[model samples]
Target: MIGLGELVNSEGEFGVDDYRACLAAKHANLERAIQEEWERPAPDQISLTALKRRRLKVKDEIVRLRTGKAIGRRLAAPA
Candidate 1:
């Protein structure tokens, strides 16, 4: 499992926008994997669930980085 620390550098080597873009790409790849798994004749529920969870985490991080909010903090409900 890839952690935020792995994608980010503590030495200030990379910027926040770069991390956001990486997370976005990772999220998109996870979505594609989920879709492909769904299309399989024998879909693996365990793998699909794991992928979805990771995707959610990446998405949460992306939102936090973009809006300067805490990670995993729920967004306001849309009207």
Candidate 2:
């Protein structure tokens, strides 16, 4: 299964800048969706929760990529 973290360019290569840009666009769309949902008189909890979860996942991937770390890898911070 392809994951967002495994995104590739049209040339079939992973470009950090391109990936970041894509993530940014996705994040923006998610934010807009969340805002729209909130604007509704009767917001749906399920939809809001799903959107927020997806947004958070995208954010985490952006952070991980920016830090030059592979997705799903955890490194202990110095105490």
lDDT string for model 1 (1-79, tens) is: 3445555555535456656777788998999999999999999999999999999999988877878764454333223
lDDT of 2 by residue, 1-79 (tens): 2344456544456656656777788999999999999999999999999999999999998998988786554432223
Considering summed lDDT, which 10 consecutive residues are worst modelled in model 1? 70-79
TM-score of 1: 0.70
lDDT (C-alpha) at residue 11 in model 1: 54
Which pairs clash in the backbone of model 2? none
Name the best candidate (by lDDT).
2
- In model 1, the number of clashes is 0
CA lDDT for candidate 2: 0.78
Give RMSD to native, each candidate.
8.7, 8.3
lDDT for each candidate structure: 0.75, 0.78
